[model samples]
Target chain A: MNFSHIDLLSFKSSPSPQKPLTLAPWRKLLYIKQEYPDNYVDESFLENLQKNVNFQSFDYFALCRESTVITEHISSVLIFVAVFIQLYHDHLDPHLLVSLGSAFVFLGCIIWEWCLARPAPPMHKSFLKTAAVFFLTLLGLSPILRTLTQGISSDSIWAMSVCLFITNILFFDYSSDLTYSIQFPGSVALNAAVFACVLLASRLSTNLHAFGFMSFALEWFALFPIFRRYLKRIMPTGHLIQTLLLVAITFVLFWPISRAIAVLYMIAVFSLTFICPIWLIFIQRYKNEIHGPWDEARPKVHRFRSPQR
Target chain B: MPALNICLASDFFYPNTGGVEAHLYSLSQCLLRRGHKVIIITHAYGKRTGVRYLSDGLKVYYIPGLVIYNQATLPTVFGNFPIFRYIFIREQIQVIHGHGSLSPFCHEAILHARTMGLKACFTDHSLFGFADTGSIITNKMLKFTLSDIDHVICVSHTSKENTVLRAALNPLNVSAIPNAIVGSLLKPDPTAADPEWITIVVACRLVYRKGIDLLVAIIPRICHQYPRVKFIIGGDGPRRIDLEQMRESYVLQDRVELLGAVQAADIHKLLVRGNIFLNTSLTEAFCIGIVEAACCGLLVVTTKVGGVPEVLPEHIIKFAAPEEDDLVRAVSLAIETVHVRDQRPELDPFVLHETVKRMYSWMDVAVRTERVYYSIMKVEAPPLIERLRRYYGCGQWAGKLFCILAAIDFLLYLFLEWAFPRQNIEIAPRFDHKRYVEKAVWRH
Candidate 1:
């Protein structure tokens, strides 16, 4: 809103007993005891005010494209759950799932080594070293993990998994910036996904099922997010294709279980990617940022360079 | 004009010293001097509870209430209405003047006063931005409270604009009445300044908003530039360590003195000791610090943020953007001015003090505030239905909510009147200012 209306409204509201020209011109200074009434506002009122100083206007297509990160994250999460459901029903072999996940991780590492804008830093522990240690630890923990939730009902297990997954999706860092270090909320999201994986692992029948499922869950939850963020930055087209592939996989896998669920999933993915961005852009006109002298000044500290010459 | 019974409501008053507290006390005194009955209403500060009298027979009602934070009373919309109504009826207060926009007690008082059909005028002590959760909430509350206000007073023109925008008030109702300091208290000491050292006094709570960060950034560069210059930093807060660290790292301990947590009474002495008073506030409504410093005959170097520019004349004060390099440059210019002034024999602290005294006197503020009081009294009080309509226009959701609150406040007002019954409450005897002064004060 133009603040000039305030000057006019305030002037119009008052009972102007004398002509404004009859008095000395109004100055903004408080030091001067002017002849005019205290409330008498002139043209100079709110002259220094500036609105929408740092506002960013968004485009509909750009917003829709940007929203793909959310759709991609949701789709990938649903695909993992579908795979979990397949393993739960004994439709997918645990050994085959583990081998496929390992092969994918190996290919992702090759791409990470070659295609990164800033090449993946020299690994503190090489992927193989950490994977071996983790594999050995999981091998020992499999028997204990399989029997962990045997006493609990399956309904409660399903409910708890859904809750943990929701928590993960809500806190997940969707930003694709490599410079953005993991904050506490992002860490919470990562941990929630891992915890959900461990919970679902308890429901599996055999030790190999638990171990193999747990390994795929780790590969999907932990490492995949980092990879997806990199995919968007390094290869935007590949990222879009990857998102479409995840949605299709979720749909195809869920269709065998229930056709209604597959159709619902497709609609959710479509609206999240398409309709939500349009709604966001629709509300962008409501953005009103008022900036003037009242804002806290960001101190510009200049670095003192000592004279060496 | 007949003497008006004015109740000044704010959570800030004596026992907790600050700008708002000082404004209340002195403004009350000046109002009393003008033959108006001025009483301050504030929350209790420790054992200083109940009604107490200060100099000039200005009565302060220390209304006991829970202080939520920074001495602001908990915003119970209708909780304080009973006692407020009882006080209003008993004292026969015709005008309710509230101070400090941040003070919830003041806001509540204004709300209840409108319910009681008394003319309410609010004075905004600070400027607020339209960002941040705290500001957004405060601005909304201000809007609800000031929607039906009789008049509004801001401490500066910049502050007036801020209030008009924040509360959506008509500019004609919101006047720019700058806060005034007690001139007799801040007598400049010509002998206090050191001849050899160019002492620059820095006084404020060492917080980020006060631009203590800028002070920390610029001090070393300023010291490095001038060999004879030194700093006397006063007041303490969370950012005090940064200032200490800056001093220690630069190893200019001898050049810089950190006088931690200086009281209000000692600010004049601190200002007098330096040739320049340096203020680096990020946002100020109308900084009385620069006024007090200018009164002490010190060259004022302040950032050109908020109303700092409007407070002092250009010759006495130098303004800079709230940046490290600009502030350092401003200080350099102030140091140069001080040096040039040192060569002349025409430097007189009394003349500077007199100029400030003329520019800002509590009597002038009181007279202007009196004019506001008189003007508001002329305004017809809006009925409850009309008032609800005013609140309904405050916002979409908040407007409806404000209307509900106002309706409930009216109901509370009805309950208080029936419960306490104004007839049962004995009217407090009005203090005869003239008779008391002539008999007790002059007789001694």
Candidate 2:
């Protein structure tokens, strides 16, 4: 036996034979309206879509596939060049840079400890024990790191350092999690910087200079990401200023050819961000989600063996 | 009736044992029973290479290639094009039917077949999510592959909806064709021929998605209420550890048996041992297991998630929410219903036979598939325009793209004929005469 149902639509006004138009509540949202399988293109629909005063032409910018890799490499290259300039010019003492960086790292650590302490009153001793162990590990690792790459060449070391730094940036998850922080990037960045310093440490004339450079890298890469992330979350304006200041500082340090290249890179990066989102929106127009009774039904398992700990 | 040449393409083939493999096998046999020439194309498995026959005139070409993660061949679009072209031409393939979404092999087969000027049909057997990144990428890939296809076949109505949305295909181009079970494989176990002890069968990979977590929770409670009831759990996965923990905690050691990955040949025997076939899965499309269980003359107690409710009538199967408590209650009710009666209720054996006959059959699938092939082969604009009208409703952007792709594909077909003329290729003669005739008689 075949089972079928007939559907009837009740309207307040009588339908006309020619050029009859029946309009429902018109809204831009796609999901809410009664949908028909056969209604692909309504005759008056395009005309009404075109009539909207606010409708504007969408820009389709081409995305350079290698843009992300180029931007990351250029910025890191610029930062290293700036550090080298400071060291050669002797305007900023290597020892002094190292000391200041270490001080900042210590302060950041103290603040992190303070925040974590507030969550659990009885876990203060456990937190202190962890903090103590962390400090000790850093202290012990520094000496070993100083002599770690002594066997390797200066150029090879620099090359390795650059690769590791890039790897750290690429692998780091950039999802907008609740605990968004500069510190997250900063720590990995610092780790990469310290490895670079260790390679350059062998180039230093004295042990103290090597120690200073290593400390400087530790401070810059490790603590900076956390601070950056915290600042972005706590103060948006401050984060924007910091980003602008870094860009401006990078431009000034690079100068001449590098300066122009930096500006072009920034424009390219901004264009890339906008281009991707727009492309995604354009692609969304192709989203023909076909749902019916044929797809696998997700079972609703209600048995909770352990409802609570 | 003239026998039609049918080519079956899937990411999965023989030497592999799963629903898709069984589906391909049963379908080929069924189509052969209707006097259709069936050939299967699958990525080569270890030591299983070149063309081989599986019993009845059904030929399988185990095309040698790399098996990527989980038996799915490494998908290099256009890489499999040449070999596939050779196979299609050699076999005089009229209809190209691909199975499974995850198989790039299946997707590529459909695309190349379209480009080679053959009618292509895709059968989707699984459901996918739109929320995840992996699913998003897969969906986009599906759209690209499905852009120029003639028709799509899904196992259930829900699967049709999913494929339409996932690939952005026209709804009418898709059809709900549920999978079928071989009646001989499923029969109630004769050994545990007792009316007192109720045996509940749970067979599936013990995974999180399978709702094995809910199974672990409910089994103890079920065993508690009914002392005589015993559980036979089949298949194994990571969540088996948790099930073991639950088993130990509840101390229902002797009541439940973990068979652990029973072979395909043994599934029927394992299923027969149980009075109630329990499916605790949280989601499904058209569950072949439930149908097979029903075929075995066992009452089905399954969670009403996905397309399980639509698979069978309410009288034959008991429904429950995907939750643990509800499943426990539902199973209890099924057991209670079974006990109150002196003997098992007279379940219409014809229900399974009629359902399998009406909704499934390789000949029906092949005939419908052949129509799509004929439509693609026709050069005239009128029929092509009608097919385009069906595709033009997928989406605003997709409709235009699909139309353009289909038109371009048609042009490509004309070009390929000029480049590689069909007159140059030799067609192989039919495999057998007496057996083919005998098989057709057997089916009716």
Candidate 3:
């Protein structure tokens, strides 16, 4: 029955009519004696070889929606770069940056509550303790952090910053929605972003600027993905709105300094959200993932109760 | 037919014991009985280096090398050429037969054998997949290794299909040859099992692939349904702890007996004591364990996975999906069959032993294998250019790389020929079966 897929092979090598008719038909069983040669390719050969039995074709809309996650992530990273650029030019006040970061953090917390998703179980007592400790630590380390990479050439700092951001994007976990805390891959991405921010923070003229930038990095890199994944899972519409809001904010942030870059960024985001998903759907027809009896069996273990005695 | 001087090469052999090792030993023994000069070439195991003679004059050459993961030597693709060339020339090996797809040593041997202009045969012992990085690499390597081999052999028909797909081989060139089960070790003892209660035996490596999770699930349920039945779980692995935990959770200390990592020789003894044998392999190419259990007169209850249903008759074995409930149902069916079969002399353990012996014997495998060998022997080994042409068809990128590797192997062969010419290398004396049988060892 499994050999039904081997139609081409069986058609070509169907038992030769020239042979003695007394020979019994070839059977798949090994226990029985057969009169064919060892390498005899029976007409039924490979009938069992299945191709893409578990194939699931993707829908254009769903694919496009999935593509938004990438778009959203890219927008957030670009927004952080725009914010950093604004800070480096001293056009933006450090206190204003910190206030803006605090307002966004408060909004993220409000959204977490609005979803009535898994109650942030660890949020109650430790949230204030964590904020206090984080504030004190940054205050203590600001001078050292501000001067850490000051001696390094600007060329090296920029190159390293680019490398780390690429690493972050490559390793970031975008699918999983179970953990409030990010998984290992996501953690690697967060660490890369944090290190990149630290390298950029060293170029700041003062401790207050370094601390404000570091705080923004924490909110964006460390916590935003977990919140984004959660929002996408429980409320897809809200996730889409958040993505658009971030893209708009990034566009506005970059528009002040470079209108050309800001417009280009919008075009990239629009295509990433709209066109790539169509391309993905178009390419879905070419997907030929072969699955057969040869694939490793995935064990389904649970509190399985046998219905029979 | 003329006797062929065959060289069976694989990373897995004699010193390291498993399915492939046992297959190599038994098949070589049968080939030796047929008057073929068979020799085994594997990497050194511990201090077991150089040449050693197995029973029936089946010579083994353990070429000393660095042992790495899973007893397989380090994969230095062209590094093995010199020694393999030396062995091939000295032994006058007409056909190079490599076993096991996972063994880089075997793959390396096949590549170099073709480079030296020798007919090569490969026997795949396990089923593999197209997914996963490890399997992808393995499939690509197999495609390269099998690009121009004379013939290929698989342990089962499903395995044949799998190998053909994995390596893109012609269906006419690949043969289905099942591994032979030694008859002497599996003689059944009907009376050894107690009439008071049925004892179910599961003899497999307690690994996830062997479906230990299914065993863990069905054991308690089966015990609840059949109060008198006991279980004997043989073999050990990382999943052993899971089984132990299951037994503890169900408080089945009295009913379940864990015979951890039973020696291969003792497994048959364990099989004889059980009225039913349960196999829960998730994906199996060929299950020799079930046949052995049936030979010992145990009614077989196993998952209907890759090549398993083709192994035994419907009356002797019951099939189940890899799921828990179905496995439990199969066990129940098997238990009932065993109960009814107690009265019939035809289904007796002794009778089953004779039936299995007739159905699957090493002699049968050897005869079929000999036929394959003889067929391949007449074909001329292709020149390096023709060989490179075959490798180039493997893939756009991989083909060129394979061609380069084949050319390098050709250069290495020339260097070895110049460094250690055939005239300089002493040809080892052929094993005389007649003289060996006449003479007896008396070191004492």
**Individual DockQ of the candidates?**
0.45, 0.13, 0.41
What's model 3's lDDT at A85? 92
lDDT of 2 by residue, A1-309 (tens): 000111111111223435335555432221122222211222322231112233344444322322333343345445655665566455558667766765776676576567533432323447447745765565566666667777888788668866876666664434332232344554465466555567766655545555566555554554455465565555656755666566566676667436676677677656654566577657755554433333233544444336331
What tier of docking accuracy does candidate 1 attain?
acceptable
Per-candidate TM vs. native? 0.92, 0.68, 0.93
Candidate 1 has a DockQ of 0.45
Q: What is the DockQ (computed on Cα atoms) for candidate 2?
A: 0.13
Q: Write the per-residue lDDT of candidate 3 for residues B265-375, one digit (tens) a residue.
A: 788779888998999999999988998888887788888888898898987788988888788888988777776786878777788888888889888888888877877
Ranking by TM-score: 3, 1, 2
The segments of candidate 2 whose C-alpha lies over 4 angstroms from its true place after superposition are A1-190, A197-205, A216-309, B78-83, B189-196, B206-208, B220-227, B236-252, B341-426, B433-444
Task: List, residue by residue over A20-72, the lDDT tens digit for candidate 3.
Answer: 57778889988987766667778888776677777777877887889888888
Q: What ranking emerges by lDDT with the best candidate at the front?
A: 1, 3, 2
lDDT of 2 by residue, B1-444 (tens): 466788999879777777889889988887776667889999888888888888787888888778887688888765776678878998999788899998888987887786666777788888786656878777876887776676677776656667766786656566556677666446445465355688899888888768887787788778888999989898988888987887788777887888898898988888778788899877787788887777766778998866677677777789988777788889999889767544544554445434433434445444444444444444322356655664465568877876776666556556667787777777777788456557676654
Candidate 2 CAPRI assessment class: incorrect
